[model samples]
Target chain A: MPSRAIQENFRFLVLEVTKQIESTVQVVTTGDEALIDSVYLKDDYIDNLRGFIDAKCLTVIRDADEGDERTVELARAVDIVTNNLERMADFAVNILRQYKYVKDHAILRGYGLEPLFAEVLGALGKVSEAIFKADVNEALEICRSEFNLDEMYAERFHRVMSELRAGGEQVEDLVTTLFIVRYLERMGDSLLNIGEAIISLALHERLKIHQYWALEETLDVGRGEAKGLSLESIFETRSGCRIGRVRDHREGAEGNLVLFKEGQRDKLLEERAGILFWQERFPDLVPKILSWHEGEHHASLLLEYLSGQTFQQILLEGTSDELRAALQALGTTLRAIWEATRVDEPVQPGFLGQIAKRLRDVKKVHPGFGDDDQTIGALRVPAFADLLRRAEAIEAELPAPFSTFIHGDFNVDNIIFDPAQDRLHFIDLHRSRRFDYVQDVSVFMVSNFRLPVLETTIRRRLSAVILAVYRFVQTFAQEAGDTTFEARLTLGMVRSFTTSTRFVLDPSFARAMYLRARYLLERLLAHEGGDWSTFSMPTNVLRY
Target chain B: MASDNHEFRHESLEDRTSIAKYLNALSEAFANGNLTFGHNGHAIELEPRGLLKFDVKATRKRGAVKVSIRLNWQEDEEDRDPSVGSLVISTSGEGK
Candidate 1:
């Protein structure tokens, strides 16, 4: 009978073999076959050693039956090798099956690999348990039987390979299957090696010496690595904390006033910058960051308190025009932030990728009026392709503009008002991205404004006002010689922005929006009679 | 339970204490609660010290008007840092 230590060795060998087979098959089945084929045998020095142990385990069991002194020594040797092999082979069969599944599908497996390997390893564990039992002399005999298994596997492999050689075109399926068969054969060979090692341990006093050295190194290496921490410090600190605070002046005013924490420092300094910037641009924004220390955890701002009821609260009491005016104010605040950022630059770092990503995310709403989810009545409009054309024409007619900084997120919440001052201030400056002028305007139209209240007519008029302001801002940029581009590239970039969002909006609305937008764009394009592709703008118009 | 002179001194201290309490409550309520003046001049300004006191004045062209009020001593950091606190309020006011 095998010792506990030998049983553990057998278990490890079985599990390791199981993992290798499963991972290999998972790769072939999952369309990661090339990746698996590249690394499958890179670390398989132990297979031969396991084969030797399985062969020897039989010897030890036989010696025990004969009551020889060699039986005890053989058991100890089997203990080490069998334990290692069992652990390796436990997932072997499932891994082969996974490869088979991947080959049959002839496609890349959609799921990730980690879970597949885990499940296979879990199932192969039962075989390892059988090896560890003291009374299982009969179970140890299986190790002696796998020399015959290898012959069967080799024959199957040859037959499949021969069939593949005779196959015609459309061989992806056949080739995939053949690859699966090869992985399956290798898996059988690994398991057979384990069985042979178990048998060998039963017959001899010592198992393969080469396996012990490698196993020791592998185990030591695995144990020496440090593990990652379970939680990040920021998340841990904020777990139960709520936003906003109230301080009692008389009881403890002194401690709360001097800001010291790191988060507070960044927050306060940012707030100071925000206040100064707002004072320069739009003075109406309230809760002004008065002064902030870079050392404080949060920014300190002076707030001009708002006393009026919220728009939602006053909905019943207000007239439609007042509601429209309030919403228009929100729209204006959003546009102000966009206008301040010089988004017309092309080569600014982080500009291209962000624009491209945003372009990709905008919905591809159907342009037809009859679609079930149409937002606007059917309006025949040029496809995104045509919009690109019109944009190109405009670009050719216009001068190339340099890129400028733009408010990255021009949303409703950033707007603040003080009726006393009749002022509007925009806050939350951290999302400053550089892109084309239209990027800010388009995103504001889609994200900030509601569908029903903002029809194409309103958007068109608002966009005109925004464009007029943009034109004024662009003059400053233009004098700086930054707004230069060939008409075509400008059109392409603008088209990309509009189409990107058009893809995401409801089909009917998208069509109406796109048609109206194109009408405005065509007016710009017609103003410039030349083709857009022939135009060019200076690249170095905006600098960091 | 005290002498007449002692009692008189105690009453004087009580008046000062009451004033502090009253002013603190008024200042706090003005900052936090929704107390709208009918016109521009109705407003409250609070100083940073522990005392609770306020000056209610008329907006642009209006005269100062008497108003009914209630006060509570809620606090806010006069600035952003949590270390300092200024009384805030959950107070109410009615125009006369």
Candidate 2:
């Protein structure tokens, strides 16, 4: 809480519009025409005030240092709140004009507008208080107002449809009546925008309504109390999920925390299932799922945040001994899981198919990767598209002799190392499935290869790490009598190397990955064999 | 190590006058059948042969404007395959 108050004009603008909304309710209550016209005229004043506040916000932001996140976020929230307030005022004037179209107020009663108007008024009152006082609970109430408006509109809409279907008279009046509720819905959306801006102001991070709800729900479920607990979002993923860590910040509340994730329903479902699977088998090897909830199209997963450094942190920052210890622990975990969960089912990994699915994304990022077939005197350079068909032919015969529970996207970042406990944990398990262990192996190798560390010493360390894992997995394969492990690994590496490029933006790095794919495809095309065991992945190719 | 590799690459946003100047130079080069492009210690000189490929493309989609002009021709002294198809990586554990 900054002892210095927020700028007065922004507060004044929001409060002024909120007062107008209350007065509009009064007009709707008393059916006063002159008062309605005054509400309509006051909308222009709100618009001008919005402009003044917007410029003042920009000036405040421009004057603040870039590192002053608090000042910048405050200015941004004020700007967003003012804009949404102006929109609500505009919607108010629109409703007043449209209400005149209904000649007979009796026929206009679908579900009634009084309840909708009252909710908007309630939500608008909170916006001024939420922004000025930095009240998160009040902001949440404003968000719930949007939800309430939706329910009222849904009921009204259902009745309107029935009346229209009945082929009754006064269709124009019925439709205009619906438009009034629609305007209410629009005003509700503005309130949501204003509420979210204030919530973002309080948390110092911007959040969507679903993400805010996810955090609130997770907190409530985790400890049966969400009041007085502040939220801080760690990051928002490209998938539009919220990943945050929650803490009990009370005086005696020390070191009790949980990782909160809210994402697409299907993704969180997969993650919950994966965590349960790992819990049933190796309890300490993955995070404990504390709570889970699904709302609308999104889901929230609350897990005890594991206490350790990720393999990524070890590789990038820790000592060489730490890296080696992490790798060895990872190898041990893989061996245990593979041995325990290995199923006797011959599975073709469809590595080429995986590459094919992601080709569009790859070309979307690096358009030049979509190469054309070239003829150079005596040589035929098949296009990348042509290479896939040829490689799929080789991939057809080589299937792993068994399937195991594997992390579908097993990169270094997902694996956590707790040196104190000498244990490994997995997070981000949305992609877990019963598949060939080679998929995890290939991703591990490519992940180590493509670490973005160009320093000579660290690059060598990555190569060594890749080699160590490859040897460990290869020994496991040999003992399991998976004869075609090397061949399947070749195809798997090609799939990983190619699809991984789409996620990277550095041109040279993407090129390196794309060329490796091309090189592997060329190798597959050149090989003539039904004996898959003779095929081997080149260690040199994986070095860089 | 004389090779038939002539490379000229550029990427930037050119204003109207700058583009006109570049186009005029290209037009004169086309008339003379010779073009030289030089920048930052990298340079290339080319002379058109019997057959030349000219490709022009303009795209306006997805909030982007792209214009490309390409001219290519085979060199007279080109007798090699001009392919790295013989590239082979050893599977042996040399690092071991």
Candidate 3:
């Protein structure tokens, strides 16, 4: 039997899970809308109870006398079991929410989930008993019962998909049912994790849970002829891409290979194509694509790893002289790329169209965005709709500029600079295309200023680099006479700052960027009745 | 009686001119130490007292922005309440 503290918390957790499961069953069986609120409320209570049990278990383990290893193991098992129980409760809530999507569908009312629900409840009860009593045999039985739940989920999933594919009018209903069954399967998986934790406690052996199975699969080096390979995750993005370093066992072949995995296949293919294009044309500046694997469910690419710190790291750690050198190199590299890809024919500028579309997107996400006083502090900034109107008017009066193959996402973090080799390498070329050079320039400058740090010294250093790059680009293009430079740059800044809100999650960061975008819009409106050519860039552009 | 204790009343005014007028009225009431606001059949009355606590907060998230100003005061009692601590004010940059 477990200790008093473990047994007490386990009893509370079991009670909470039982309540959650009952509410979920009520929602599915009775279609009682009021019970849905109870389900969510109970889920919240279960979450709090889980936190309390977790703290109590930690206290038990910490306050245990020396040489009390058995108590520590029991406490750890209780912690793991309670956590899984909480997750199971969450999945129950998810099932209820998904059920709402199909509740009104006529086809779903006759479909029965009673047997599967009964089996899941039985398994949950057995697991709870196993945890509270430290019954290894019962926990093992729960593990065996998971296979049945998986089979039921698969059978139901296939039936739902077949119905969906048959092109019935209730396709939405079928899809929601599919998700509901999937959540039930995931709940079974959570129970299996709890079962494994119990077995580990009884046997006094550490066992790896299923969630770490993917890492274990990746570490399995038996598939290839390459020997002694090590994998380390280096970066992850919101798009679910995981980039890792693959080092070889051989002395010379190590640290030269990078692996990109776990993102959309088409995006990975596009990145591979982009890298190949640049590798062929600008051999010194792009990593060479080694090999690619496009499997049924997973896609990945292997590329040569470039050695150096990113431009962001350089800016943060390098000396002023080093920063200036890096900026000059960046300018020179951009000039080369532009010169090579510049098209003689001028295309109608798409600046206004892009800005208009982004404004609509932001407004769609937040209907009452610009009406709040906190948006621009004390300033009376125009609404996004008004800004779009002014931008349209301004675009009509401006001449079309030349188009070049510009890096669509030319942020500092995407560029790597090897000071030893005096070469710059580019990554994340997914957005590369032919566009206005000012877009790249604006993104680079704004990205630098958007660093979280706001020290005056760092700001001055960054401002110097931005001004130097601006001067270099202007002189290179001989665009001093070009009337559209300042106006286009301002519009680019507006686009950059506004669209950045989609990526930033922190409230203050989002507000600051929104205010900056509004500030640019205010500047643009100030020149509404004046000459567009004579409008100068703001001196405070890079100061922030 | 429990339902009545839990009753809530809310009114929203969006027009700038009308909101300004309402604000002026509220300002006058604060100066007079009593305020009563009502719309349609629902209304609330508040009496101002010594030592009002004021809070101003601004928040932006997921493309939406909000600024809230709240004032609160406690009714005087003969026995001191331990739960009521010293009033504290903290401020940060509007956009930081």
Candidate 4:
């Protein structure tokens, strides 16, 4: 039923969305204000195109002959594709708008988003090719390549979340980064839909691309068994994986099974291998890997569903006693993990490298902060760049301590605590490795303190927990005679305070954090003979 | 979108003195009820007789500040004195 004009318009819409994607990629990678502004300008044009397509599609559908199923179906497909392309363009505009915030803040350089833009642009390019050529093979490639985007999204999302949990400053920028990646992932999803629609038109058969892929994975269970297995959609990961709980009604599986489809055999196998490794070492800590399937086109892992509340949930609703208990248990678990993973060899602490990177990010976001007389809140802070340079020089004189195994992402949210069984479980352990134990300790302390609640009671309780953990860690460091403990902790605090800038949008909270970091840097500079142990942490550092 | 009856002119001035000179020339034309200007052999003339509308605006963004002044008036109508609104100016210690 669609006319030639409508078809041409739809093609043009696809091309325009692709162009928008290209421009967004450029803006994100290069931080070009002109490109960002141009994207904003194109928004009106994209909206107008969407309106024109909708009108044309409606006219075609109304004018179609009675009982003309093919024409009607074709018109519907065009309408769906047009709607998706328009949404994709809207997301492109959203990315640019967020980029303005990034530019204003100047946290551009170390986000590692350029590679993601490249991947998304590449995926979008293939989608455009598939749509233009009406090539089924190209369309299939787009569908298959979605897993790559999902993988990248998951990696970036988890990393940012970890940094946030660890008190990485630039919270605003990191959160924006998360949204931008999410938009890119959604754009990829729409592109996949467009690719599927093209394939459907070319083959003259309706195909739901995602559903087809899901069915393909489910059918591997055997056709007869697949029919009885019902999948309820849970949520999609940022990395584009379709995750759901599958249950066999006929067999009455004891627990709901989690389904993970990466659409690639090797990647899924790698994940399965990692899960198995954790299951072997920490049997009670991770979910059980029940079964896995690897097909020619896709791979999936079925994991046992662990029933309990995540630590994030408990933190919100749990009483002070419950929180204290959780923190105590958390400290014990961390000690166990550290004991299991600590190495005899001492390596240089990456304080200078880490602080230098964050300082650069801060400079990027608040270039004016480099001025010595810049006032943050009621406090006059020295040039941030100069302070960082001083901190680097001070760090050069300190000793590097032994490394320990740590949950690289020690955010409470990733932890699951079963009070009834008195057990602690961990998820999203992809970043687990041998690193500074302070990484976990600092993240735990900050995560507790960073909860959105502002009530005096809640703040006091959270502060108490932070103090308890700090004292516990300090005791351990003293018992072990780790003289560099204070310096390492100071560095961790610096990372936390500066990175808090990204997360806390409130001007007062941000200024408090900036002033806190400035105070610590001043102390580090004033301390003679590099004796970090004598450097006292201000009691009011966490006041805000 | 081309019009034969419409004429437009543009010029950039180096400083306030040059801007004042241009404003003086335009003010004299308005006072005489006849406006004329020539540049690069292109010239225009008009007889103005109407109440004029004046606008003033100031804006600051992204480190740049701009203040714009504009005047618009109709042609071939009886002249009338421009109406003035109540004006109250206050200065703060903070410099603009």
Candidate number with greatest DockQ = 2
- In the range A1-544, model 4's lDDT, one tens digit per residue, is 4677876777677778778888877766666668777777887898898889889878778888898866766776677777877888998898777776773334545656666667656656665456545566667666655666777789988988998898855788888888888887887787677767865654455555654455445435532234345555445554455556655554555435555444456656655665665676678878777666667767666676666677777767786556655665666776666557667667665655766666666656654444555554487656866787777767676654668766655666778887776677776565666567877776666676666778855665665666667776777777667777777777677667776466566665666566667777766677857457676555445433
Tens digits of per-residue lDDT, candidate 2, A1-544, equal: 2223346676677777877777666655556667887887788888888888788788878888778878778788888888888888888788778777876667765356779888988887677678877788788889889999999999998888888888867788888888888988999898889888988888777778777777777666332235555665478776666788877665555747778888888878888888887788788878998788887788898898899999989988888767767877787778878989989989888988888788899899999885768765587878988888877767777778899999877999999999888788898787888999999999988988888889866776676778777877777788899888988887888888988998888998888787777777767667746576666677656666
lDDT of 2 by residue, B1-96 (tens): 224575667667789877887789889998998877888876677777544545567899998988787876554322334321211112222111
- RMSD (Å) of each candidate, 1 decimal: 26.9, 12.0, 19.5, 27.9
Which residue pairs collide, candidate 2?
A: none
The DockQ of predicted model 2 stands at: 0.02
lDDT of 4 at A540: 44
Whichever of 3 and 4 has more TM-score, that candidate is 3
Candidate 3 vs 4: which has more DockQ: 3
Winner on lDDT (1 vs 4): 4
By lDDT, the better pick of 2 and 4 is: 2
Question: Compared with the true structure, what per-residue lDDT tens digits does model 3 show for residues A300-393?
Answer: 6667788888898887888765665566567668777877877765555556577666766665554454554334457564676576666777
DockQ of each: 0.01, 0.02, 0.01, 0.01
**Candidate 1: tens digits of C-alpha lDDT, residues A1-544:** 5555455555555655655655565564455555454334523544554665666666666657555655555455454445444434433433444454443453224222333334334434434543344212322333322333345446655655666688765356545544544443443344444444543343231222222212222222232121110101111112221112212133323323211112344543554554565555555453444222222233223233333334332223444444345544544554445446444434422222343354434532443321222122365544544544445434433443544444544543344443444344444554544455544443443332223334433433333333333343334334445434233233433443354444445554454444433444444455465544443422111000
CA-based DockQ, model 4: 0.01
Best-first order by lDDT: 2, 3, 4, 1
Q: Of 1 and 2, which scores higher on TM-score?
A: 2
Which candidate leads the pack in lDDT? Answer: 2
Clash list (residue pairs), candidate 3: none
Docking level for model 3: incorrect
